[model samples]
Target: MAEDMSNEHSQDDSGLHAWMLAWYDHAVSVGFIRPPFLLNDVTAERLEGYFRVGLTPVEGAEAFFGVAH
Candidate 1:
């Protein structure tokens, strides 16, 4: 599924999108309301990557429609 979202011409989101989505699913499977995300500004490849994809700003977000920027 990660490969599907990384299409260069359609959307240039970094690999971070895959990692973030994985983290969210994993956290939910583990029954976590708020997962302690490891990726941060220090690790994120680019700040803009956050906005290109559809996801909560915080991984494993407690609520939907969460901030992604």
Candidate 2:
């Protein structure tokens, strides 16, 4: 059976957004965001790619986000 996802994108800029932020924070704590996230500025799309492809190396992560080496 398919999971119910009707409200997945419904609560934008609300509690759902906060929950997403919490998930990001968890990722940071688990070293998923890497250090100096400010300098790198990883976007959501790039992060999705990281999850899809697995193991986003520092160089690849930098290049993926268009950060100058």
**C-alpha root-mean-square deviation, candidate 2:** 8.1
Model 2's lDDT to the true fold? 0.48
lDDT of 2 by residue, 5-67 (tens): 545435433543454455456656656676455533356555445544544344334444444
- My TM-score estimates for the predictions, one after another, are 0.31, 0.32
In candidate 2, residue 57 scores what lDDT? Answer: 44
lDDT of each: 0.50, 0.48
Per-residue lDDT of model 1, residues 1-69, tens digit only: 767765763544444466567656755665654656565664354423443454444533433324556
Runs of candidate 1 with Cα error greater than 4 angstroms are 1-12, 34-69
Clashes of each: 1, 0
Q: After superposition, how far is residue 14 of candidate 1 from its true place, in Å?
A: 2.8
| Model 2 ranges off by over 4 Å | 1-12, 35-69
